[model samples]
Target: MNKDLEKLACKDLIDLALLMPKKFDDLRLNDAPILNELNCTKVVIKSKKQLAGKRLTCIAYSYNWECECTITIFNARPFHNALFAINKELLIYGKLNDFAGLLQFVNPKIIKNSGEITANYMIKGVSDKSISEIKKKYLNYESLKAYDLLDEHIKLLLTMSENSSDAMLLLNSDELNECLKFVEIFHHIRRLNETYKNDTLYKKLKTHDINKWLKSLPFSPTNDQLKAILDIKSDLENAKHKIRITMGDVGCGKSLVIFAAALMTYPNKAILMAPTSVLAQQLYEEAKRLMPGFVKILHFSGAKTKFMQDELQDANFVIGTHALLWADISDASLVMIDEQQRFGAKQRMRLKELATTNDVNPHYIEFSATPIPRTTALINSDIYSYSFIKELPFKKEIETKLITIEQSKELFNHIRIENEKNHQAIIVYPLIEEGKTNTYKPLESVIPYYEKHFKNVYYTHGKDKEKDNVLSEFALKGDVLLSTTIIEVGISLPRLSIIVIVAPERYGLSTLHQLRGRVGRNGVKSYCYLLSKNEFSDRLIEFSKTLDGFKIAEIDLANRKSGDLIDGDYQHGASFKYFDETSDNIILQKAKEYIHKLQDK
Candidate 1:
């Protein structure tokens, strides 16, 4: 790679080919020059005269037009005087002007050749000549062929590299942009495959029958859940290691799938790491109730070290928070992470490393309730296998409303009625303390009012050390809970019937969806109120129309014009130069089809 090319962040042949020119200079000879426009013509210097202030004036005779034209060079140096000698044959290119009815060329440049167009680049610290040289070396048929690009794409890029009329024709065509978008996605998927192909399983996992266990369950599993289980079964039985992400909507029974995976890895051990201790305990309780009594299930958190060490040796399924990362364990064949996006990459990698031994990696699976758009999921399927569970175990009936401060009396009355029914309500504030720019009351300022009117009021924030305890206590005896967005994921509140978000317009649609999901967990009537000073918000209005998290994600993507609403790690900083996640769905589909064909071969 050239040092100058490296400065422009060109990493490969594809990158070099995609470095499009900002503009092109057409120096082709013009037979008929237009007045007050840039023209190129062959000319001969008939006479030259030096003026005051180092200016030179030359009378040039144009061969094509058969006319004499005036040429003026400002601040003319010694080279300029020498070049414009008497009767010198040359090609001049510049803007022709009519100064007082006289045809003139002001500061016209001498062109060595007048039949070819030239490309001009706009990169800082890199000259146009250097960029042209780099392109000539890398953006060729042979070089692009080595990267397995299609012939059509390579030819289009080659034409773009050359300075010609054909290059301009292709540059303005839609076919060229589509080709570039396709190649960008194709190259990204290939790189991701190569990066993930490094690890393999030492041996295929032994299959375990889940039919008997399914029959033992109290209710029938949804078809999506069954399919996800089968996908995991196939991955476990393969010699090649696979990493799969199973995304489900809120209260979509993902815990059942987690339990099923544990059942498949019965004799061998399986481990699940959750983000919060409250969620870990919830899954632990569900596992104990659902799984057979024969399986040894253990829950580890901030408890004593000796107790955890003793149970770690023989436990079939261990569920815990980040405390699981520090525990010593070996020979585990499966690792599952619930709410996988909550943990950093290093934290997830550390948990996976604890289970890896004998040069064999465990089958990794991530479970997330953060739903994404279907198009995005399809695009990312090239990198990782995905299973979506959009079907809820039970249809949720939640009334979402947009409210204002003028409706405070009605909002307070609704809260009181829900409280009178022995149901719980939660109010989420944007901040803990008031700031200069705050338009709504902070949690601290409003705590007094809630405490005076509502009995058994509990409050917590993300930075509170005892938030877990507070949440647990609130779930048991509290009538109202006040907190930040920390309750966005993981704690199952069956009795939570109402969730009022102060300044709801300040949050993303997906986040509002997740927060709304906290209610109506157990098929009870629930309500979500969006309290804002503004009477109307398009995003909030759209969010209140549906309870589908995936659709909410699409709306959010459309409003933000960014893919960062999805997992941040998968986006690679959302820095795609050509591929637009918002509007390039068709191009992505074509690229995926092509890559699939190659994989089949």
Candidate 2:
């Protein structure tokens, strides 16, 4: 703890010193600006012709030293409540600038005076009827020595606070203590994890054994697919408990990574959780079919009966949706999370807690076919443990097109004809409503676009409530399912060849990639149509055209102008906030470094 923190009354002085703005619930500014004492200066309000409308008061304080000051109290605005309700001294924020020959303050924070004194007083009867009482109670000290007491770091923070525009520049500085700590720690831990990961006993598990185990399968795993499986095996068998993230492009065999991890953890069962039951069901079915003989892979979904839950008892490996958290199973030794971000932090922790409560060491392997912003994911310490699969499955590619809904008909019919000839098509929509609404683009509203254009059409969305069952039924019966992002991850429709996304520009790059993942499952030539409005930028348009997730991530990062994308969303772990710095990078880096240094110790 810093020694100077004791002098501060508030417990959150670091945050206060940084002046990080919070949403205005009540107006109680603790530290507002103060003007030096004035000897014989008469200030005027000149912005408004009439003093009654709204005017800012500039009071020149010049007793011992000469310094100009302006005090602004909002009238007839939402902020005026402070003028009537607040009686405490305030440190007015905002610039003491000149307006029409008189100094003025604009949009100032009404800071409260707590255990401090200053000489500046509001003019008598200038705006308020109760000025005399407010002045009489606060007229004692000529100067408050608050600035002299600020530490060097606290002073730098205040300086940065005064100039909001230049705050980000300070963040990129390597010489700063925060950055130094962050960079050193991140590099050390990253290197350590890499070293430890390489030395695990599972690395010695020959790929031949894995290959022979899957030899009876109808298809062979791709080389990149094989490498991912090996990586999972290595992590699971490591000495330390594992929490690894496996991020790859769509259909790069992340599921195979889960299977391989499950295979490595012998005598211990695996728990895989998906966002939806359809995805979980698909994983359960596939894992059951591919595993070695006598391996029990049971599934538990919210849609399942008590009998089904009973069947999952004593199973070696279990797959399920959020429903598994309620299960009474004690055998799950490894937790496999697919589309990890879809399940929030609480949901993920609940699963981990289930394993811990049973006194069993459970390793976690998270899979994300859609690559999210890496920096954003790392902001939370809880979800930072991750690795990437940068390679693609094969040299095979998918042709992408950006067209309007009207133009999609011709392509939809052509794809339908192709589907009849051994190729299947999937049409993805962004909404479930009949008309335009807030936040979501309804598919029922977009159905008319392809109503007469194609035959045997189906639709699904999050608004459907029981969308998992609808998606399962649609996957089997409908030739073309016009769905929302509900089918983002883990659902495998093997025969599907084409994906048509309506309003693709509105969706995140990660989501668009996942939607495209629905196709290209069987390694046949696949196509994804992005039907977007003209509002999309050229770069975003180009991004939608590629099947490469890593490329898209790079482009997204390059296009992001610093503080965008990841800053506002609900973080994966603890709600990470910037305390003394503008970016949470320093705190995150320091936390990671501390963890690594402790590991070394």
Candidate 3:
């Protein structure tokens, strides 16, 4: 029997029993059962040593009979962390073994004082006991009814549930209950492996009116756009009431797909929401131009007047900013969201509230250029149905290259020649607006750059109200656009050929795709220059070497996961911070499981 382990209390004894090999009989009191397991000594491997000629040569040493088998090896120095220097007693657990006739203990676990185990120490080693440690901290669960433990914010809003479905006001409880009921009902009614017969007007265009629209268009919808449209259409048709989420590359014509759907669902009210006023206005004008029947569009933004909000209520296909959320939407049936992930879960839940009433819930179609990490988890959990449009629209090849300051000079010379040949170019930097104590390049105040490089150069940033107007002019009449990433979406001009992004490594993959998207609208041979000055620029350069947007996206998503803002951007309203994907998922799963067990209790 291990003497050191005898000192452990009942709780620690149980922990040891749970962790040790089953071959070791359970510890019993007063001559109860068989007990052969010893408190084994922990030996840390100082360095990789070959077992040669009946001996293992190393600084490492193992105790013949020490309990609590925990040993830590430090990578910094040989023999480092192998043993306590001050002869501090440790409870070690391991089996003695002979390797090449030399004694060793291959695996060991430690039972030590809680205070001695720092957070950093616990994280460094991988052991079977990790599960127990994790269950102990970071999780405090109790039993309550599913309805009882609902977040307080949700509960407070639920009380006024009568107006829950009204987008203008936050949801009250009745509205939330109504939405929950509808979701439950829809979940029951949802069909599997279903596809809708293109009965909508958008489907009509595909068969009859599409050619006309296609013929009228100077540029065709990229194959990617068509696929996305079809995927969204299928989701709309298959679900009991369409509930589909679609993701695509930036400038992938997501709005066009929405417009086509709206056209097909005409005479039926469709309400589209954009996160920002600028995006909302852009969507509204584009939808109206495409559908063209006195569209009766009302835009509700923070900037809208009371009169605007009042009139917006009756619009058939009202589109606008969050202000649209304030408009009464009792009659609006079809709900669509652009940049859906930008809003928090609470905001999105509000949208769901607006789309439902006590009796009926509107079908929802969510659009995102950047797919939230939760999308996959949701799909895995059978929470949401999904479809993807992964293909690009055109075959015209665009060369994407990463350039440094020196490389950018040569690229600039080439761009200059292209500009002289009547083509336009865009040079993008990270900072859209000038700052007081700035570190990033000022894309807006680049007068010195303009004078040094080109005959005529224009700048546009997010802060500028004339951003769209300026970008349009630059694409049409100007020789060069020395600008920021604001032109990543929706703006189209065929003559604008080259996009040179400064400090490309600072931008997300989605942002880069959008920037590249700005010029490829016309299927012309476009060029994208990725510029950076950081160590990470090597990765950006490697990414630029590939023209495949999806491939770049995959790499970017992986790299972004390692950043501080990774979880901050997604999981809106989620109180928990994520340290790692696997850890977070396991924690959530365990929490949910605990809740379920409590309910069972």
Top candidate, metric TM-score:
1
307-357: candidate 3 lDDT, tens digit per residue: 675576557677776765666776666778887755665566577567566
Per-prediction TM-score, please? 0.82, 0.65, 0.58
CA lDDT, every model vs. true structure: 0.82, 0.56, 0.53
- Which candidate order results from sorting by lDDT in descending order? 1, 2, 3
- Candidate 1 regions exceeding 4 Å error are 2-5, 27-31, 34-116, 210-212, 218-224, 302-313, 323-330, 344-350, 372-375, 378-380, 534-539, 557-573
Residue ranges of candidate 3 with Cα displaced over 4 Å: 1-242, 248-253, 275-279, 292-295, 341-347, 369-384, 388-394, 432-440, 465-468, 535-542, 545-547, 561-601
What lDDT tens digits, residue by residue, belong to model 1 across residues 114-192? 8878887788888877788788876778889887788999889898988888886677579988888888878766665
- Candidate 2 error regions (>4 Å): 1-220, 308-310, 358-360, 374-376, 379-387, 390-393, 405-422, 435-441, 445-451, 463-478, 553-569, 572-601
lDDT of predicted model 3: 0.53
> What is the alpha-carbon lDDT for the whole of candidate 1?
0.82
Cα displacement (Å) at residue 166, model 2: 17
lDDT of 2 by residue, 407-456 (tens): 75588677868768666677676656655454445677657765666566
In candidate 1, position 144 carries an lDDT of 90
